[model samples]
Target: IVYSWLFWYHSQLLTMKTEASVLVEVLDINDNSPVFENHPATVPVPEDHTVGDEVTSVNATDADSGFNGEVRYTLLGSAGRFSVDQETGVITLAAPLDRETQDEYRLVITAQDQGRPSHSATTTLDISVTDINDNAPIFSKQQYEATVSEHAEVRTNIIDIMATDKDDGENAIVTYHIVKQEPSSTPLAFTIDEESAH
Candidate 1:
């Protein structure tokens, strides 16, 4: 009986070979926030730009993969003047722009990932509305009446003429000139300063 039991045990040990062990690693979850790349902090746009025109584009990226890496854009405090593409991040003018009314616009752009708990990042987009020569110079008085003595000098300082332009920069710069004199043949008696419009 002992000899038979020993042989059975030896057979069982030979049958039970070495078992192999396997290991697997689990990936990380979405933890990184969206980030913008090579985007301009400030953009200059003409005030006369038509509606629906493309103002600028922004780009962002997420480190996570699959749905977690998908990013959407949002414009905060746009006030219907501008719109942004959620997928493309392209910003367009939604309303007419007027530098006279509002010279600059401060926009906050946000990029949010499509993860379960969305991660977002923000950037400041400063849009400066450039001036346009849309407004014409207007004189304060419709008509001018001045009295000059006959003995007045040729270079005597005449009444100071004032004109104002609503536009900005060079568009608003006013220059005084005598387009038409009282008498066509009369010599250039009066001269005004171009800079001061006097």
Candidate 2:
């Protein structure tokens, strides 16, 4: 009976000798903030662009996995004039653009992850609104009066005329021409400068 008991204890020890191993990998947490792909960002928009026109696109990336890597875009201080897509990061015009009203716009764009206690990054976008011809030239004075002697030289300098245009660049360029002259039957005796408009 002692030998039998010893055999049973040996069998129990052999069964207990069988062992297995396991592996556990700790996944990365949402620790990294979103990073902008572009720097010193700038976007050009025409002043005649409509409300739905697409201006530009912004991109960002996150190192984390799953929701932590997902990015959403937002535009700050646009005053409802611009919008960014949350998923695609495409920026579009939300309102009409007029360079005459506001020549340039500075916008702050942010990219945020969807993780809990979300991390975010920001970038500045400089939107330059190009000029468009929307205003006509207006003379400074409605009428001018000048007296000259009949013996005055043929190229005598008359009163200086001035006109202004609110537009910019070539749009604001003004050229002077005598559209209508008094004493229509009389020969033309006065000329105006094209460059100085005098």
Worst 10 residues of 1 by lDDT: 1-10
Candidate 1, residue 133: CA error in Å?
Answer: 1.1
Tell me the TM-score of model 2.
0.82
Compared with the true structure, what per-residue lDDT tens digits does model 2 show for residues 1-198?
A: 012111222355455543344455566678999999965567778888988878888899999888989999999978789999999888899999888889888989999999998999999899999988889999888988889889998878877889999899999999988877766645677888987966
TM-score of each: 0.81, 0.82
lDDT of 1 by residue, 12-68 (tens): 656664444444545657898999988778899999888998999999999988788
Q: In angstroms, how far off is 91's CA in candidate 1?
A: 0.7
lDDT of each: 0.85, 0.84
**Model 1 stretches astray by more than 4 angstroms:** 1-28, 188-191
